[model samples]
Target: MVQQTDLAIAPRTAMGRAVKHLRQQGIIPANIYGHGQPSVAVQVDALAFDRLRRAKNTRNFLTLRMPDGPNQTALVRHVQSDAISGQTLHIDFFRVDLQERLAVKIPLKVTGESYAVKNLDGVLLHLLDALEVECKAEEMVEYIDVDISSLNEMDDIIHAKDIKLPANYTLATDPEEPVIKVSPPRAAALPEEEVQVAAPEAGTPEQTPIAGE
Candidate 1:
């Protein structure tokens, strides 16, 4: 089951350029909308939201506590950031129905050592980093593990269909797509002296001798 964390938020009246003042005071402007409900403008403490974002599992459901309204269960839909400074600019909270299934992308983590990579000096290629899955809010997961121990030879691959998901989770990605693979080790380059010695001299018969000496 997914874990839930409490986040305190309050309705905001700031809009457009005026909201920058809130950020100057260490508060972030945000919105809450979903389930055919009217969108709400809100704000949260920058430090608190930062802590929640840096938490172990970013996929956790957030219990938005409001002083004037009942608590709401929401998912972080999007976080806008300043490209150069990497500062949080805005946030979007998506309210969800706990019992209703929703599609979301979950990260994929490579687990277990591959025999081909450990013993054969092969390269491991991770083709997919995340998978889209459909599941109820309560069934959400932080990440799915893809074990590679079964890859014993170069060129061996693991496809999406091979992944085993948790109960109540259904894959939304193509099953036949390759997720990971092992590639043969690259050949070492020969020494310059070896190449020079292996080549024929300029006057050697191997080269078409001057037409009619």
Candidate 2:
């Protein structure tokens, strides 16, 4: 089932340089638009937006509550931020139709330790950190877990096709792409031996070359 978060916002009356004061007062400028809809300028409370962003994936459904109009469903499309502080300066909310499928990137999370790594001293290599999938906004997930416990030997690989997805969700990434692999442990480096310089033979050690003899 799709989850929805309701956020209250007000239509933006300020524009251009005049909007700087809104940010100073903890309001984040934003825009909302989608198919068959006119772009609507809006503003959301900075602190409230921060909390919501931290708690949900960008693919999640958001219901924008407007002061004087009907609420709209949206998905975060882009965020503009301060280069120095990384603070959000503006955001673009793409209105979404819940009934339509959308392509989204879900983060990959590794679960379960590999027996080969623990018992055989094999090294684990993570090749992919995320995967793209197509699903309705309500069916989108924050992350997909990939289990590594089945890797039993060095050179064993887990490909994108091996992943399992929720019903109604289809993978968008190439099926042959490797998501994880195990490799044999690296060889240890050998220590260098010290070189010994032999002294001159004892018999003629005192014989110095006679200059102009």
Candidate 3:
């Protein structure tokens, strides 16, 4: 079962430019909408939200506890941040139905050392970083681990079709897609000293005579 994280939220009356005041007071304005439900404007503690975001997988379901309404199960859909200051500007929570299967992108974590890379001097290339998968909210995984230890020779590849999924999980990505590969080591540039210029043969016209001769 997917782990659940809880966050306390409250209804927000601020809108437009007025929402700036909420941020000034260390509150984050947010919206919750999904499953064909009307969007709800809400507010949450900035510090608390930051901690939750840094500590947990944002893709995991979040239990939003509201002061007046019933608790909501949501996914942290999006977060808008200031490009310069890196401050959280706004957040969007997508409410989910635990019983329904949903498609979400799960990060692909590369694990285990590749023997080709360690001993054969091969270069390991990570072609894909995430996989799109469909699974019930209750069965969603934090991330999928892709072991590269199977890569024992150059040109060895791990394709999406080779990935094993948990029960009830189905891949949304194309099976032919290459996820990772071990490539032959890059060719090293020749050193300047190794770049030979043929010298003129001893009696050739192209040879220059010695100054004293």
Candidate 4:
């Protein structure tokens, strides 16, 4: 639900050393392509891109203000990172139509401690972390919350259709997907049995000594 201001970018950023120079200046070199339009290389301010990432609508459409032509509204389709520095080195922007639906992946955040872990002495296990959804680009969500307070048994499972998602969004993952499960604590180790001791040799040292003598 967060909003970001228009991002300013340069129109013509060429290949090879020129793009490397862009990265050297704390500016991330990127490309915007989609809606069947030709791809164009661009340079976005690193500081500004960081702000947009923290704005809670990172995967959604953003208003990109190019240098020359009309400002294009784009969906942040792909982002490439520098392997060593972990910086945003490249990005792909997709031109979007506001009314059109886009399939995107949404994160699932689990909340609340189960009584199965407290009163019943059990452990909580979460199976699924993120799920895919189909919705309007503008309706995309940052994350979904799944509450586990209602779980009380060892076999309790939280299903996709059970937890609530954004009304504007539709779950693309199967409804039977298990998000979380509660199980009883591990069983105590069993006591080891005493092993039987073997009898000594029938012949004694005295017999060997007498025979040698």
Candidate 5:
């Protein structure tokens, strides 16, 4: 279910310097590869591509509907950017096989504070930013959400084993991966004993101490 937006962009036809000019106008030249069909060169809105790339839900699973041909169910496989302006230079869209399981990295979304952090004043530490998974095209999720409301102790760590994964989705990452944990935050400055005292006890018995002695 692709949400329709006015973010339409015409495909790019020019190459070399011409393409560079198009990119300067906030348009990105790209290509779509699908279903044994020859890859087609397309132009995407530079702003639109940037927005879609950062979208929380469609960041991973997105299908592009071509005006001339059939809809391309695809994922962004690669992206190139301008060195100075940081604008997108090109993007690669890979056609998806609905029946095949694809392995992709999806971001990890954590919601709700752990009880340990709330009651014990501990900090919630996130270990994993994303996880790889094997899933069919339709079952591909943009992200994996881990709920931390169950954590109840200072050392409570929520590992991959504790994740409530979606149906038909299997973890392709290490099972023992630590996703989140609760630990006390470090003080900005060390306590008295934690700080290193002056070696040689300052001037103790040394040549004379500075005038401030």
Candidate 6:
């Protein structure tokens, strides 16, 4: 079984504009609800949640330790951030059941060098960065490793059906969708040459006979 990361949070009483004060104090306001229960308001240390997000992200299940209740397994459902600074403002966690299956998009992790990219200088394009998969909470994964070493030509592609999944997990995305591909290297643009036009030779005005002639 994959080890789950632990996140500790405290029950929150602040609501409305008062929640802004929590953020100023390095506390992020959050809500936790799932399994058909009313959402509970909570708060977590900004620094701690940041570390946890960096380590486990939203794909893996988190062991949530609540102040007034039992620890629960949850998945990060939504994260609201400061548009400019990218600071985390709030979060939403959904409680999960270990024995039940759930669908989530697991990030794709590329591994190994592709012969097309290494030898032919082909560009590698990731058509899908994540895979929609269904699995139990205990079987949730942080990311799926994709091997690109099999790409031997510029047009070579990898499809959803080509990737192997964990024993309990199944792909929810279409099997024929292209996951990754190698494209021919882009051609460099040629520098434009400066063209100088010779000044028009000094010319004398042509004289015409008077119109009444």
Off by over 4 Å in 5: 1-11, 34-37, 50-60, 188-191, 194-213
Give model 2's TM-score versus the native structure. Answer: 0.80
lDDT of 1 by residue, 135-178 (tens): 98878888899999999988999998899898978889999999
Model 1 stretches with alpha carbons more than 4 Å out? 187-213
Estimated TM-score per prediction? 0.86, 0.80, 0.86, 0.76, 0.76, 0.82
lDDT values for all models: 0.90, 0.88, 0.90, 0.79, 0.74, 0.88
Q: RMSD per prediction, one decimal?
A: 5.1, 4.3, 4.2, 4.6, 5.1, 4.9
Q: Which window of 10 residues has the lowest lDDT sum in candidate 6? A: 184-193
For model 5, residues 1-213, the per-residue Cα lDDT tens digits are 123223344555888778878876877888878678898888887777777667633355456766665665677788887699776778887877767787888788888778777777888888989988887776766578899998998778888878887888888889999889887766622355666666786557857668977
Clashing pairs in 6: none
RMSD, candidate 3, Å: 4.2
Between prediction 2 and prediction 5, the one with superior TM-score is: 2
Using lDDT, give the best candidate's number.
Answer: 3
At residue 158, candidate 4 shows an lDDT of 90
In the range 1-213, model 3's lDDT, one tens digit per residue, is: 668888999999999999999999999999999999899999999999989878865667899999888999999999999999988999999999999999999888888899999998888888999999999988888889898989998899999988888899999999999999998866732334576898878887766789998
Residue 107 alpha-carbon offset, candidate 2, angstroms: 1.7
Worst 10-residue stretch by lDDT in candidate 1? Answer: 188-197
Cα deviation of 78 in candidate 4 (Å)? Answer: 1.8
